[model samples]
Target: MSTGMPAYDESGDRSRRPTATNRTAAQVNTTALLDRLRTAGPQSLSALVQHTGLSTATVNRLVDRLIDEGLVLEAGRAAPTGGRPARLVGFNARARSVLALDIGSSKIAGAVTDLEARVVRRRRSAIVPGDDARPALYFFEALADLAASLVKDAATGPAPVRAVAVSVPGVVRRDTGRVEFAPSLQWYDLPLGALLEERLGLPVRVANDVNLLALAELRHGAARGRRDVLTIALGTGVGASLVLGGGLYAGSGGAAGEIGYTLLGRESLSTPWPGFGDLESRVGTAGMLARMRERTDALPDGFGPEDFLGLARSGDEAATAVLAEVVDDLSLTIGNAATLLNPELVVLGGGFGRAAADLLVPAVRRRLQGRIPLLPAITGAELEEAQLIGAAELAIDLAAAAPSPPT
Candidate 1:
């Protein structure tokens, strides 16, 4: 578990031992410098000092330290600056790799990404999650197998694997790394991060799928410019991720955006909703399809949510009516959320959500405009496999945060 960096040396100028506070500051400053180098590309010692706002002496020492750890490399000499060419140092994002997994109830999509979060290769496998009657061993073994296989495939030596990030369709405590529940997967109180770390010999970070998707969007998609945004996943189950003040806001219990559980209407105000919330129960994939089924028996067999949206788009009468109802439910839920949060943007995401976004966004916007005083601009999620991409980005951050490889 070397983190592909030299060992962290606490003893700087042994003559005067550094205090714990000083060591912490040094670590933070070093990370800041490395981040600057990673993002700004190659720079010479003097330029690094200017870019990082660190003293020339500090930048020189840190650069030399990173160079020793293989995290920094001499790209070449800089342009002649009235004197001898200065050596330019750059971050070596390829010095280490990461494994990012997007684990859905039916499938596990994995990829090996570089420290910069660029996908190197991808793989996926079908999954049948175990239930209460079944042991958890099967699920775990399958996951471990997928991680091992992904790492093996990418072990061609461009970079060494450093950490892992996983995306789960459930409630996960960000601080504890324990899964609270996954209705579809039937996984509860699962210590996914610890288990994976023990098995893979690397650090693991696990998060809810919707949150990760939001992270992906903010990092590399439509939420880029917005300071306050909501990323709602409209899939098998409804879930949302919140970004407030330019930061991923995981509430105290990591359930900040569980909007799916909101009460649907006055009729069910006191009714028991054990699993799927009223909003989700009414507007989720199953709910919309159920509406279609109730609409008519003349429709084609084996039709699904996607087909329902397609029919609605094509102006099928029954499907359009059903779509209207679905839109109403979604509009109510999204409008309420917008009224409360007043986010600058609302990003619709997930399989069903992304596909139906074209139809949903405008309708929701118009409804909210009349109902609420302020309305946020709504948009569909951009980027393929956004959850996985978010996982990759998290894995990269985990790797990057590792104590600058032990110089």
Candidate 2:
């Protein structure tokens, strides 16, 4: 099961006789140094020492370890500051590869990416309605097959996949890496991460799709510079993810972003889906399409949410009316979230959200402007494949933190 390449240990050797508290401190400092270099670009040893507030010797030792692990690289020399020019080091973003998956309602998308989370190869497969009814063995087999194909097709030619990260439309238990609930996919308490790790022979991480979207925005998309941010995804369904004080907040049960279940009106005995809740039935893509169908029987054969938005933008009266109603419902829900969280930035993402952002943002803002005590900036996501990108980010992080192989 060895990867042929030497494993990396971001926290240095844990078997050393350093005190537990000192080891923890060193690990934290190492993470901070890597993050600093990754974000601020290359820096000289002295510069890193100054930024990290660590002693020169400590910084030098850490840098040497990182370089030996292939996570850090010497970029060049810095300008002399009255003495010898210091050599600069930077994150080696392409030194390793990660495999990421985005399991959606009707499709599963996989990609191979570098340490920078840039996709190098991608593949996808459709999921039929009855697929989930099959045994978990079959499901895992199919997933593992797809993952193997993706790895084999990596453009780098047989490079080891350092880690795997999967995104599911569900509440993922952070501690157990279990899908606690996934109404859309009918998954409950599934140990998906463990199964994947067993099959792939590598560390695996799982997260909620919406949460990953928020992470993508917070790290590399529109909400990059914001500390408190909210990402609302409107696709086949509706969900929200929160980032508070520059960190993703998954709440106690990993359900912090389950805003789609918020009640907007009286509860119904018959649900849209088996476990779908009130607000989702009203504001989700399915609801929007149903409403559009009710308004017009002459609808195009394959009309979808995107097509409806296009028609609305082109001044179709019926489409515009349908969009306005959905916008109202969404604005009300988002306004409630805004009032409670008071996020610095609200990023609208997902297929429907991104397509209808130009139309929805203005209306949502108008609805919130008068209701909330303080208004926050609202905008659309500026990144594509946000969930995939975020999954890659998680994979890179897990790979970077993994223990080094014995020499």
Candidate 3:
């Protein structure tokens, strides 16, 4: 199992009983169905009825409730020379907003998004060196201020902020909201969720930054509509998210998808690769740079990975050799993952993954050509702020999942 962090449960239990709701199970199911429709895009009533196996009358009633709640809106008429034009329904992009915040080692990024996850406002600020604890606190305050400012600019009446989604560079347990380990930010076992919830006065959902990126992609990026997908983030640290049956497979303890720690040299090489040393040893963008430095002296003094890619592009022999090594390693790792997980789509993401696409994709494809049965389709993220965008979706999901607040 991929391991990074333990799931945090404030109640201190692995299993908890479901709450008795004011509504029936069927009602809850109908509400969830409507939420899905909003996120996935507009659907006709017949489509909903067919997909959900709900009766047409029941689906109609549910849609009526959602329309009244301002969650879903009528877009237009579906095409047909039918008796009556079908009313197109989709999420109201302006109904309310979700705040997504992504805390990276280098900077803090925030986005204000509508219920449909369309970003309206965005802000990014570099981290200031000081006590590590203070930066998270400060950035969140700034994020909250940005959110308030955005809300004020909108014309919607008392648009209640749904929830805050935070993606941190560490292993997070959303249930209890703890950071088991975050090498880039140098945080360990931090009570991030609860603290953020308390500080922001909004329910907070915390998750690994890469996982959020994967979630974003699954929902709206290259992996959309793919039930089995594997997204590899190759920048600072090599991490992955595996989607099984269209939902994130977080494993037994929220530690799944930590593919960076996958033991590499065991079968392929004679030398025993003592693998990913410590925090920062195997995680993040800097970690990869450090590994490159240890292996070759051909790189320049102030070289970044981009420079290496440039050299490879220019056919510089030494740079090509180093670049090839990374591709080979990555391809081998991906091949192994493919053999095991058998995901339908394998999306390559992160800064490095995006920059070295010319180098990464061909190599990954070549590595799996004869080795795997059906190679996963490799693709890149379409959006620049996929992780930040997904964070907002996570927050909205949490808010919607919660028992409706007291009337």
Candidate 4:
């Protein structure tokens, strides 16, 4: 997990001409300078040169470009000791903004954020289960409405909307940004990115919800400063994400960490339930509800996923038994992943995961102690809007990399 503050490498030859290579490298390195300002506030040009260890000429070139790009603005002067005051530069975070959305199975949530990926405004709409069964056009039209609403007020803000990034509950095609399959949403091969970009007249990035969540944890939450991690999301569904080499690893097909499909036993291998995977069927919300109904009928109907965890926390015998089973499944999954990826930490997130984290983290640690040779540090997510905020950060990156800033 990267905290998104990679070290500034001043290895470029100071005397190199501004060729295509130099321009490309400068564009990428410019972000490091801006990120520093984002975290450390304004600084003198001399200070930035000292901090980055780049030659004064190189820093001056980069700062001039950033000013032209509207990402940095002159912020008065710093006091000097008996010499001319140093010119200051600061990150202009509000000069540009992006929209982020998470279209989960249970609801749709979105936010508008500035360049630093801080949420300036947010909106969420609850979705009843099975609502996706409606016609795709109907569902999407409504979804687009909500997305538009998130940015409709952008005109009045300090920044202009530069781009939009969305996370969907599905396997997305890397090249096309198409939703290959989303069983929960009944969306298949949907050109979501292009459609939204066409509608909004802005750049759009679409990615897997879990992948975004993992990025969220890596950049803005509990897994910060870690280089490798496994973040599991236990909500209405069960899924996981991998952060390797301090970045997200979307496998060859953009489906690397689909742990929900893992088979726990030999019998599970023969089962052919494609909609919900084997591990997911056992540990997901439906699975817990099923186990509760099997063990005891004390709870009334219409009980939700969080209700089950809450009851278990209250020491209800049947709920506790079901929770123990969930913990066992999760421990097995985490132990196996740690053995392979050797992640430095493990993060538990999502609605159910967040709700049960206080109760689950300790039990999981005890369960994996002797089972796995190398145990990892376990923690809950620090951000409730991990997916949405992660998308904002990614959108900001995309905007910064564009040849020209948004009009």
Q: Which candidate ranks first by TM-score, i.e. highest?
A: 2
lDDT of 3 by residue, 1-407 (tens): 11111211111111121222344544444445555576557888887776666678877887787677676788788887657977878876576667788887778787777766777776777766576557555655664565455445542544556677778877777567698887666567878777766666667778887778887787677876677888888776777787776667777777787777666654434434343423223434566566666667666678887776787799876666666667667777788888888888888888888777767788778867988887988877676877887787776655443333444
Counting clashing residue pairs in each candidate, in order, gives: 8, 0, 4, 1
lDDT of 2 at 390: 83
Q: Report every candidate's CA lDDT.
A: 0.78, 0.77, 0.68, 0.77
Clash pairs (backbone) in predicted model 2: none
Model 1: clashing residue pairs?
5-405, 5-406, 6-405, 6-406, 6-407, 7-406, 7-407, 8-406
For candidate 3, give the lDDT of residue 11: 11
Point out where model 2 deviates above 4 Å: 1-22, 129-138, 152-159, 266-274
Native-to-model Cα distance after best TM-score fit, residue 185 in candidate 4, in Å: 1.0
Worst 10 residues of 2 by lDDT: 8-17
Cα RMSD to the true fold for all candidates: 5.9, 5.1, 6.2, 4.9
- Rank ordering of all candidates by TM-score, starting from the highest: 2, 4, 1, 3
Order of candidates by lDDT, top first?
Answer: 1, 2, 4, 3
For model 4, the local distance difference test gives 0.77
TM-score of each: 0.87, 0.89, 0.80, 0.87
For candidate 3, the 10 contiguous residues with the lowest summed lDDT are 8-17
User: In candidate 3, which residue ranges exceed 4 Å CA deviation?
Assistant: 1-27, 39-47, 74-89, 131-160, 266-301, 399-407
